[model samples]
Each structure stands twice: as C-alpha cells, then as structure tokens.
Target: MLDFTNDSSGGEPSSQAVKQDAISDQALLDAYSNAVIDVTERVGPAVVRVETGSKTPGARERGGLGSGIVISPDGLVLTNNHVVGSSRQIRLRDNEGIVTEARVLGVDPDTDLALLRADGARELRYASLGNSKSLRRGQLVVAIGNPLGFESTVTAGVVSALGRSIRSVSGRTIEDVIQTDAALNPGNSGGALVSSAAEVIGINTAIISGAQGICFAVASNTAQFVLSEIIRHGYVRRAYIGVSGQTAPIPRRHAVAAGVDNKMGALLAQIEPDGPAARAGLLPGDVAIRLDGVDIHGVDDLIRALDRDRIDRTLEMEVLRMGRLRTIDIHPIERKPSARQGSAP
Candidate 1:
C-alpha cells in the first residue's frame, strides 16, 4: 500500500511539518480578514451619507452624493466642499437610517474641508480624533465611507507614505496629505481614515485618477485645527505676514549664538512693499530669530504657525540685522479670496 501523507522516503516527520506550515498560513489569512471586518463594523455607524444640490438661474437644482463623518455628538460633520459644492440643499443620513436636512456652518476651499450642522439632531455618533503626527509608515489603517452610492463601505491598507502633497481636480495643492492604498471612491470624501485604536487620523478627500490603490486624505491635525476655527468663527482666520523666504545655512556670526554651525533657517528672499515685514522695517538678509516669541528655526516652521491663525493678528518677531538684534511687531493680512480654491474643477 502506498503511503499518502509521506514522501517517497515513507517518513512520518516530513508530512507533519508540511501540515503545520499550511495550518499556520491559513491562520494568518483568517486573522487579517477578521480584523478588517471587525473594524468596519465598529466604525461604520459614524460614517454618513450626504446629498448636495444647488439651484442655478433658469435651471433645475443640481446635486450629488458623498460621505461625511460625525465629529461631535451634537451633529457636526466634516466633508468635502466640492461634495457640497454650491449646494443650497444638504441632506444627511444617520446610522439609524434616517435622512434629514443639514446646513453648512463653515468651509475652507484651500484645504477642501467643510463643516456641517444638522438642525435639531442632538444625538449623534462621533468618531474619536487621533494624532496624525505620531503615525508611522506601514502602520495599519482603515477607511470607512459610502462609495458609488454604496453606503457604509470599508477598505483597509497600510500607510504608504506621509507628508505627501497632491493637487485636487481643480488644480489646488493640498499639503501634508496622507497617502494610502485603500480603495476610495467619489462618495468616500469626508469619511474617516482611522488607526487600529479606532482614532480618526485623517479624512478621505481625494484620489488620483486611473491609479489603483492611491488615495489621499487630509491629516487629522489639519482637520482639527480647521474644524476648531470654523466652529469658533464663520471662516478660517489665517495670519499672513507678507514675506516670502527660503532656507539658507546660518552665517557664522548668528550660528555661534544659535549654538550650531551649518544650521538652516529662513533666508529673507523678499519682503513685500508696505507689507507687515516691510512696514515693520525688516529688510532683506535679516535672519529671523523668532516669531510670536516662538523660535523660527526654518521657513517651514514659520509657515506652519501662520497657516492656521487669523489674518491681521499681531505677532512679535525678533531678528538679526546687520549684526544687530531687533524686535518688531507685525500683523498679517488675509490672502485675497480670488485665489484659486482646490485644483480647477
């Protein structure tokens, strides 16, 4: 009789090892599937379906569908502005399968985030916010949303990269974006990109065309900052000191005081005429020591601080000019509203 479980050597040991390997492989696959499924079920209730429309002159109302995420128990939801683009009518669908009307509370087309509030909807399921700064590459993440009108859809993948910049369909550059391989469709905008702990790290906003598994999300840090500003004021109040700068190695003189040679910081490229920096007597070649009492180590740091604050707010700046240190207070003006919002669609 031929031995079915053994090789030609007829040993019991070889067959046992092969069987164990197969079992282990199967177990790993099962675990992965279960994990994806489990996460989806837990978070899907907070994802919502949104319908947007607008009434144009001499035309019937135009509208579309997208996804949204509840960020507050009192009915605040975050979604894409384009999804709610020019829409006078906004409808929100709750987890209990009820559809109700909503209104836009605030919107920032630069980041493509819009805040919505439901009338009289006090009871809502909100997602927990996570710190996107702590996320590492290859960490597991899941996206929950409505795709192609398919409500409550979930997809999973690992974080492909961070700090990616993507231009929207309308041609605006989105900064500090999160990239992932998770499947996201049109309706996925404003959905949540959550960590294993179920904390919302990002909001699904855009995807590259004809690309498989390439999706972009707005970082939660940016989202939270924008959301808080919107909730506080009707619009984003960003401070803008009218100065464009570049990073340059610190000169020997300033390096000594900074305690580092070969250090990098803003190299004043241009100070707009009559602008805050110019009006405050900041000339070209002046090394900025600090802004608003916070150290300005580089141009990026300065930009980050200004990105979320209100325009026309006064900031104290310390600078080194002609081997002399001076302090000045300057206020930033708002960027013109005519600036293109999003990438050109």
Candidate 2:
C-alpha cells in the first residue's frame, strides 16, 4: 500500500524542475486518475455483491443488497452484521460473474461485522487488510462495491477523518471508525474502502441518509480483531473481572511506579466476593494500573484490553492500593449477555 498523504503544495504546482523520469504536473493528474482505475481492477475481484434473503414464511422473500470483501483465498468473507442479520442464506457474486452460496461463520452486532465462508472457492482473489491506524486525513482512497446493484462500481475520494465513532444498527457504539467522502450508495454497505495501492483499509458500513459524500466504514483494525475472534470462537467474547469501577486519576507516585501514561486508572468502587479481582488480592478502593502490557488510562482502556481472546487467560496486572503499587494476577471471566445492561465489563 502507498500509505498516501495529501501533503502536496496547495494552490499551485511545485516550481522544482521535473526530472527525466519524473511525471509532470499534467502527467501526474493523469497518473492519479489511472492509479484509481488500476486499483479498482486490482481489488474489484475481491469485492463481492452480497444478497441476503429472509426465510420466514409470509414475509418478504427477497432480501436487501450489500457488498462484501473476500478476506481469504479459502473463501472467508467479511461484511456488516446488519447485512446478514439472522439470515443464513447468503449469495455472493464476484467480478467474474460467479455466484456462489456462502455459510455464515459468525455475526457480531457489537462491531457490526460478520464472517462468511463461500462454497467451492478455488484460487479466489482476496484483499489484504491494511493498517487503518496508518491512514491520514485527505489521503487518496477508492471504494469498490456494487452500489445500487451496479456490480464493481468504483468511486474515488480522500479520507475525511479518522478515529470517528458511529452507532451500529444493533445500537452499539462502533469506535475508531473511518469517515470518507467516497460516495457510497445503498448497496455499498460492506464494500472495500481501499487505499491507493489497493490495500483494504476499511469496510464501508453506513451513510448519512440526508448527507452527500459522508460515509463511514468499520476500520480494518477493528475488523481484523473481530474476524479473528469470530473465526476462532464463532462469536465475539468480552472479559470482566467482576468489579464496579469508574475512570479516575492516579497518584503521581503510583503512576510513576506503574509506568502508566496520563497518570490515570480505573478506580474500583465495589468488588464482588470471590471475584477475580478480589481473589487476586485487589481491594475495593484500589485503582487498576495496567492489564497485561497495556496501560490503563481509564475504565474503557481496561475493557478494551479484556477482549474475547483474553478470557481464560491469567493476565498480570498492577494496582495502586493504600498509596502503594502492587502486582496482581487476574483471570477474567466471560461477561454474560444478561448482565450487559449498563454494567461494567
């Protein structure tokens, strides 16, 4: 991937002499346009038009249209959870006009990402996940999708913003979202938000109905995390230590001792008896300093680190208690679905 930046001089073209091998200003413009076309060709094969239908009798037979990206040559695909919600009968068509049945591997509403396995995949073209954290504002980006059922449609634009938060259809807050003015349409959901060099950086997810050029994609980083868990466990998992806490600042000495940035931590207000933290010698008034190797700046940080992969694992932790730093080992358990309402995780 190019990892492009919109750092060119604004207003006028550069005055520096163009080298023999260098592309001129006019040629640069043509090259830019051609590069986008090339990217569309390179990544389009991996972009699949997804059609999901409801199996409920007496209901609408035809489902809606969406897009998806082939993430593995063995036929694993990624798309928005809403696109495949409660619908196991999924059909995918690639650029070669090959339509095939797909099986739902998993669906995670919290991140609005779902995984599918296409049937009879041989030499399937797939897109490589890029580092969404490396994306810069105004960098050149292209989206390949079947917008409005127009298969393999291509649109080019710059990234509008990064680290945005959008609400998922399941009413969960999707963090670290990618905002782009790439002109996504109704069938563009779950399409590939590709970089200049054709790396898949994000999966197109949503658009503001009344707004033009404002679209959102689930960041590739988040998709990677969700896909890994879904592939391994058939569902997204979260960990909790059975404690009530809130974000709080840490004492200067304790912060220095724990090597935590921002001098902040999660201050525990209550500890359930025989809970992981309580059994690990954590007191109700203690402030968690870190989990594993991740520094805890707040309760959110602690929660983010306690993902599905963290369950059943004994993680080293640091806490500030009684004006002293202490080390603790906690084995976080899975947070139950019933306890998810306004509860700490």
Candidate 3:
C-alpha cells in the first residue's frame, strides 16, 4: 500500500479500475458460455442420430450415419437427403439413447433435404424453425449435432455469410444457403444450426474439406418450403421449360427494342429437343427478357419465374432475337425425377 493509490499519476489505471475491467471481461465470457449452454439445453433433445444401411445386394452390411432434427411433436424429422441416400427406412437415436425407427416420407434431392416420420412417435420434443432470412453476418450461432458419431456435440461460431449457392450431391444448385463458421464434420450433416434464442435457423449440410471454420447449411426458409411441398404433394414440383442458358449482358439497343430496362438476360445456348421452349419456337441465340411479365434479368430470374404455379400453364415469354423483341407463348411442364440433364426455365 506504499503508493498504490498514486498509480494513476503516470497515466496507468489504478488497482480498482483494473479490478473492475477484469470483472467486466469475466462477465462477458460468462454470458457467452451461458448462451451456448442455454441453447444446448433447450434444443439438444430435438437432435438425433440418423443411421442408414445400404440396400445393395452385397453391401447390406454397409451403413451410414448423420444427424437430424425433430421439427414436429408428432415425430417429423428433417435431415439431409444425402445422409439417408436412397434408404426408405432408417433408425434414429436421441441424446438419451432412445432408439426408434423412422420412415422417409419425402425427399427432395435438389435441395438435399429429406423428411421422416418416427414410427408411432407422439408428443416428442421438437425445435421450431426460425426465419433464416433475418440472420446477419457476425451474429453468434450454435451448432448442435452428432459430429463424428459423438452424440449431441456442440460448437459455437458466427454467421460468416448468407445467400450462398452450393452444389448438392445430386448435382443441383442449392440456392440461398447460409454460411457459418461453426465447426462441422461428417456426422454433423442434417443437424440443427441454432440461434442464441434456440431457434433452428439452418440445417447443417456441408463443410469445405480440409478447410477450417468454413461450413454451410441449408437455410430454414428453403427447408420450410420443401417441407410444405413434401407434406402436401409427396414431392417437390417445379415447372420446366427445357432450355440450357447462362446469364449474359443484354445489348443496349436490344434492351431498348425489347421495351425493357434489364441490363442482363438469359442467353439460350441450347433448346431442348421437342421441349416446351423449342416447341414454342424458342431457338438458340435468343435472350429471354421477361417471363409472365416478370423481368428475366438473368438465368436465376428465369428459373424463379418457372415456379410450381407455372407448370402446365400457358405463359408469355418475351425475348430479344437478332435485336428484335418477340413474344412467345409456352406452356411449362412438371419436371420429371430423372430429368436432370439441363436447366428448366
């Protein structure tokens, strides 16, 4: 105590100030720990281990494992389609080692999502899906999954990015993906990516091999759409106007001639033989400017225009061919399960 109170004379903080700072730092750390613990306690029960066995004649013994999240009290579980592969029946095990069998209700390979119902499960604990569209970069997130066969593993990180597109195993582009830094491993697929409020914001999907802190999840909004479609129709229905194209810049003159203000459009590189677009006289080298009065600024826009509602419905397509605007009426058809050769827009 010789002159401890005079420590501030040299511009150094006094002992009391140092003590207060230490306390504040500890408080922040405690808050972070509490958040993770609280989320785990609230949502961990809904996380389950999904195990699938190969139905191959000689590979019946081969099996795979991943994670899943219970979304309905009556036992609807959501997981990645790749996790379950082509298996129609699988086993689920929760954190408490309760094992149950679940049957695949529906699967959408394009979005890498699958829905399952536990046999006779009722009043089960489940988690609520949150609006992933509201997530912001740098926001804290907690991942609860069974990583590498470790049941109920927990990892904490931040939302690194959003609106990302990733290719699924089925060779389809999954749009509006959520990128996060939360650690993920093989068995983590199909688990829940939760917010601080314990809402499931995403379904853990992929991780860049050999990369640290880089992971991706399917956004909850996409999952919700897939869920509803699967529940109502038994499969995801998408309109298909067979055309292969890419986004290309529109010529200023062509833009003016088309009476549209889009700077870019989908350049039709190929028209599927006898397909809807070809049947409607749409040819290669034509740039699509609008569909059903919706501006087709790019290939994505064109894809979005051909929604489920557009299937089997006559729609007007505006295009610029040889600098001249042309309107073509085409009826889109429902895309087939085996038809994954080209884009259907």
* Poorest 10 consecutive residues by lDDT, candidate 2: 12-21
- TM-score of each model, paired residue for residue: 0.71, 0.69, 0.87
lDDT of 3 at 249: 98
TM-score of 1: 0.71
- Over 1-345, each residue of candidate 1 has an lDDT whose tens digit, in order, gives 865665657556675798999999999899878877777776778889998875689997568989999888888889887788777689998667888789998888868888999777468778878899999999889999989988888889989999998755443456889999989998899898988778889999988889998999999998898889888877766666777776666777866764543366666778888877788888888777677767777666566566545467777877766656677887867754433253111
lDDT of each residue in 68-121, candidate 3, tens digit only: 999988999999988988776699998889888899888888889999999873
Candidate 1 lDDT trough over 10 residues, lowest sum? 336-345
Q: Which residue pairs clash within candidate 3?
A: none
1-345, model 2: which lDDT tens digit per residue? Answer: 653243465533334433523656678889899989889888989999999985578876688789999998899999988788777789998888888999998777777888999998476899899999999999999998989999999999999999998866544468999999999998998899999978999999999999988999999999999899877777777887888788898777766665655577889899889888888878888988788988888777776787877888999988888767788989999865431123455
Please give the RMSD to the true structure for each candidate, in Å. Answer: 5.9, 8.6, 3.2
Q: Where in model 3 is the C-alpha error above 4 Å?
A: 1-10, 54-60, 170-172, 248-264, 336-343
Q: Which stretches of candidate 1 lie over 4 Å from their true place?
A: 1-13, 54-61, 167-173, 242-305, 308-330, 333-345
